[model samples]
Target chain A: MKTEEMITRLAEGLRPVRRMPSPPVMLALWTLLAASVIGLAALVFGTREGLDRPMTRFDMMHSLAALLTALLAGLAAFELALPDRDRRWAWLPLPAIGLWLGTMGVGCVGELVRLGAEGIRFHVSWPCLQFIIGLGLPMAGLMLWLTRHAAWIRPGPVAGFGALSAAAFASIGLTLVHPTFGPLMVLAWHGVAVLAVTGLAALFGPRLAWRVPA
Target chain B: MSHAQPLCLMLAPGQVARDARDLRWSTLMAAAQEGDGAAYATLLAECLPFLRAICRARLRDAAEAEDAVQDALLTLHRVRHTYDPARPFRPWVAAIAERRALDRLRRRGRQVARETLLDDAAELGAEGEAEERLAACQLREAVGELPQAQRTALQLTKIEQLSLQEASARSGMSIGALKVATHRALHSLRRRLTGGAP
Candidate 1:
């Protein structure tokens, strides 16, 4: 069909639809959902046995960093979903991601320095990975569904950040339930799950979600 | 990959054109959002040339380019509510166009692959049947090009492989007339194939 004819048909069929909420509003909604999921997971799984341990500066820093990372990543994902919006918005989460990595690095180094080679023992928990992924699945699916109408210019970055946002929020829940393991172990397993989710989303998100008219 | 650069540095003269177009579209879109049909029609009408240009640039085939433009327009209509007046309109439109073009390309690729597989499968079957199939196609074309009476007679008797009496009954023609029509069609086909006058 001719372009003019198609355009005419489209205009004739136009029906007013409510505009999507702004990125900030969507991010807020996502955050609320993430918090609810984390809260529910914590309640169901139970908090770690050391509920009474005095919160350390490191612990506070880590929690803050995780929260910031999730919030920033969520915001970036929402912004990236819009096509004509500035691509620079993709960088919004960088600082928070850096802080997250820095906190993990500092925690691992501090652990290594205090506990010499003999005191530090490396361990991997299969259930930790399972819990993180299991909780992350719904959050990831929700993020994808929310952004389905978005015209993704850089689908890879958008999907990567989206996966990161979901995984980070799920990690928060995992931390509350799982017993304290070595900092390095936490970093390794959590980091692996984050990377895996991000990699998978980047690879297949465009094919699955970024469909246009045939 | 090059180090990430600011989107401002990446802006080109084309973006300036986009800015102007987007400004106009945003106004029209805002009006359309408020139930202004004329404004909406004008917006879509104005978008046609731009959509055509983008589709042509992205797609090599002219027909495919036109189809992609239509697809993009339909998609734009479906997602019109997603448009934010604050954002530039061209990139939003371009993103949809590029996506549609890419989808067409991907689908075309898959279709070609499937056809290739089917051709290979056909080749693996009775090799002698290939020549027979080609001859059958040519004969069908030749018979179709004949006059109506001759075509009907040839189709009934030759292609359908029916007996003269059955073909006569089906076509409401006498056996002698059907025979004469079929004979004339074959003679005409032979002359055409042999590069002789009918």
Candidate 2:
């Protein structure tokens, strides 16, 4: 079509669009939704037994890091969705990710010190995969819905952040309920889940997120 | 700091005019988001010169530059909601135009490469043609793997250089089906060759 005709057609078809919320607002919205969904799922499934056991410092640190990573990654996704935003904003989640990894590393070393080679024993936990990914489905879906319109330019990275956020949030809820495993098991299974979710979302999100001109 | 403040105050005439234009465009865009057709039309019309300049600067071919401008306009229309009223508009539009121009450039470059390589292959005839031959072999292998319908459509339309009507009659598929099959075949070939990188 001629440019003039396209412009006229576009103008004729114009309709009021709901402005996307700012990144911080979107982050808050995702956080609330994620918390509610994950928390409800945990409540429904019931938390890990040992409710009276004292929480360790590592447990607290790990939870905080996951939460921070989710929030930062969510924010990055929203920020990167806009066409005018700097691409460097993609680095927003890096520090939190580093912290999360560091906490796992520290926990692994602490386990090794306390229990020798037995601490790092690898165990295949089917429930870990099921809970993380299964619970993560809704969170990822919600994120994709929220960013559907905004992610025209950077859909892959945005969806990646969305998946990361969802997976991390799912991990947090899973930790509260699922029986604690060895640090190595947590690292292996949980890391795999996160990678799988991120990779899949990144692979398919562009196709799902936007309708580009032919 | 005081000295620099005075220097900063002395804005150039061109900068002042550009800033004013940006503010006007932003206001129009904000209005356009509210479904103001006149505002949207005027905004797009006003943006033509700048978009043309950007496209022309980046794309040497007139037709391609024009196409890029149209693409930019379409993109701007599609993502109008992404424009925050608080931000300046020029950067947003410029970014879209620049991205579209670069896309056109990349596409043009790829087309040139393919055409040149094909021409080189034909010219080489009996001489060393290892690289082009390998590429052709890979493409042929990929095409061989396509589904029967898509392969027939591609062969009839692309390899045989038949018109869609002729290809449709020969393949016993409607024109629309042929078009879709041919498109999918090309897409599949591209994905196979590029390893699914978009």
Candidate 3:
């Protein structure tokens, strides 16, 4: 049809659409939902044994970093979801990720320094994998649903940060209940789960996210 | 790639006036979000030239550019709820226009890759007069099956080579109606001939 006629038809069909929440508001809502879901997971799984034990300095640092990572990654995902947003904003979570990884790396070194090779004991942690996935799936679903419109323009980045946010938040919950066993164990199983989740989400995100209008 | 700049920058004559216009668009869009059809219509009508300029810039083919503009308009309508009144309207519309134009270019690229144009000499020398006649017969039948208004619009505009204004006057339809009818007729014919490719 002629452009003018198309415009007229569009105008004829005009109806008030509820505006999407601002990015910060969406992030807040997502955080609330994510917290509820993760709390439910923690409750179902039960907090780790020795829940009464005080956290070490390293443990507190690691947890704090994980929290920051989740929040920053979530913010980045929301920002990237805006069509006019600069893609460079995808790096907003980089520092948080670096800090989280850095703390984990330090913990690993400390464990090795204290216990030598024995501290690096590695075994498949099925429970850890299950917990991460269980906590992550719902959060990822929420992220994808929230940012589905933006996915049409920047699917990979949006999905990557979204998955990272979910995975990082899941890690925080996993840490609360799952025994560190050793820093290496946490890195081996928990880290792998996070990577696996992010990789899988980014890979399939376009299909799982909303398709562009035909 | 060079044409990938923001449409407002490329089309707007002066920054100050453009900013004022942008503010007006945002206000109209806000009103549109509240279901004011007049505001929505004015906003869209004002945006047409800018959208056209951007699409035409991205797509060298005039027909393709027009199609892209329509696609962008449809997309804008669908995603109207996503707009924030706090943000400038130009970028939102520009981004959609650019994306639609790029989509058209990509589709054209894929088509070009898959198709090889036949030489005029080869087509003329082919021994396929019977097949051509059959195709023409099928096309005529498809045209005949169109709604009366569309058939007349198509015949006046495409077959009889009349301008849209001439066709509108002849058919006793408004220019907009004539254009819509002709577009529908062509789209219908394409679908029938291409088995729903259109």
Assess chain B of each prediction and give its TM-score: 0.56, 0.60, 0.62
Number of the top TM-score candidate: 2
Lowest-scoring 10 consecutive residues by lDDT in candidate 1 chain A? A205-214
TM-scores for all predictions = 0.69, 0.77, 0.77
Q: Write the per-residue lDDT of candidate 2 for residues A45-95, one digit (tens) a residue.
A: 988887569877877788889999999999998888777787898898999
Worst 10 residues of 3 chain A by lDDT: A205-214
The TM-score-based order of candidates, best leading, equals 2, 3, 1
lDDT of 1 by residue, A120-206 (tens): 777777878888788876777677777776533456777778878998888888878887576778788888877777777767776
* DockQ values of all predictions: 0.24, 0.30, 0.37
DockQ of 2: 0.30
Native contact fraction per model: 0.56, 0.61, 0.76
Q: Quote model 3's TM-score for chain B.
A: 0.62
In the order shown, the chain A TM-scores of the predictions are 0.91, 0.93, 0.93
- For B103-194, candidate 3 gives per-residue lDDT tens digits of 88998997786554433434675667557768989998998899999998988889767557545534558889988999999989999999
Please give the distance, in angstroms, between residue B50's alpha carbon in candidate 3 and its true position after superposition: 1.1
Task: Order the candidates by DockQ, highest first.
Answer: 3, 2, 1
Instruction: For model 2, state the Cα shift of residue B125 in Å.
Output: 5.6
Model 3 ranges off by over 4 Å: A211-214, B1-13, B116-198
